[model samples]
Target: MMESMVIFHRCRSLAATDAFYIQQLGLTLWHTQPGCHIYDSGYGYLGFVEAADFELPAYSCISFNCTDCAEVDRLYEKFKGMKGITAPRRHPQFAVYSFFIQDPDGYTVEFQKIVKEGEQ
Candidate 1:
């Protein structure tokens, strides 16, 4: 059984990435090293490594699950009016209330609240 999780990425600006994740996204700083910085994601951890030739990924997105729809709406307000942010909306196909935002490294981070059975 899989019991653990971690997501890692290559980033060019450690300070910018840290500020975006910690200040903007509200993730906690878990640790740091010469090559990478780690953030606590409640259930797991996210790591970003310093790189010189940083190229954005073609088809990758990291998602954070909120406790409820209100939290998702709160985060939508928090990230609204920012650069590279999509309007917060619902995904009927997936039954998710979510919004997408691009990080400093141009990675899409999705904040979502899943609809439980009989709630949709």
Candidate 2:
């Protein structure tokens, strides 16, 4: 059987990234390696490694799946003040109620709830 998963990305400053994911996003710190910090996202894990010279990808997205539309709405209200945040709305094509926000590292983080089961 397959276990859980962890997605890793490169970050310029560990301290700043830590604050954003931990304080702002309210993710629990799952583990800490020498230059990497992993956060538990309830569904899976997200890890960031300190790399001063790393060039961030032009397009990168990290998405979180909410249990329902209400959860998605709550997250939108919580992070509405953040830079690059979008208003939550239903995407009929994708069958989701979702929104996007930019993390401190300029990563596009999406919060979404699947409106149609088995679509995603």
Candidate 3:
């Protein structure tokens, strides 16, 4: 079957960006190059590239589903010690826990936890 995924950002710091997603967010690396890092997003992939001269428009951001909202909050807090961090908050649209943060290049990231199969 044909496949596709999103390259969320053409980042400025390829190494730093890769480390953030790999080491911090814990996304498994599918592949890596001098200019890019491909990550497995379960159903697809996410890539980060070194784009020193790329002009990016205002993007809405990508949401990653998590099983535990508290775990996501914990990670958010742990990552706060690093440079450029944001606090996690609840999503306004749905009844789920979510947190918003920026990557190395100021790309918005939403980590959300959806309700389980049987619970409300």
Number of the top-ranking candidate, with lDDT as the measure: 2
Which sections of candidate 1 miss by over 4 Å? 1-3
**Local accuracy of candidate 1 as per-residue lDDT tens digits, 22-82:** 9977889999999799999889999999999998888788899999888888888877887
The sequence of per-residue lDDT tens digits that candidate 2 reaches over residues 26-109 is 999999989999999888999999997988798899989998888998989988889999999888587878999988789999
Tens-digit lDDT track for model 3 on 1-120? 857765655878877777778888888889877788889877678887788796555765767887787877877777676554556766567777777777767777777778655643
Model 1, residue 11: distance off in Å is 0.7
Model 1 deviation from native, Cα RMSD in Å: 1.7
lDDT of each: 0.87, 0.90, 0.74
Query: What clash count goes with each model?
Result: 0, 0, 0
Clashing pairs in 1: none
The count of residue-pair clashes in candidate 2 stands at: 0
Candidates 1 and 2, the one with greater lDDT: 2
Residue 50 C-alpha lDDT in model 2: 92
Candidate 3 at residue 60, lDDT?
55
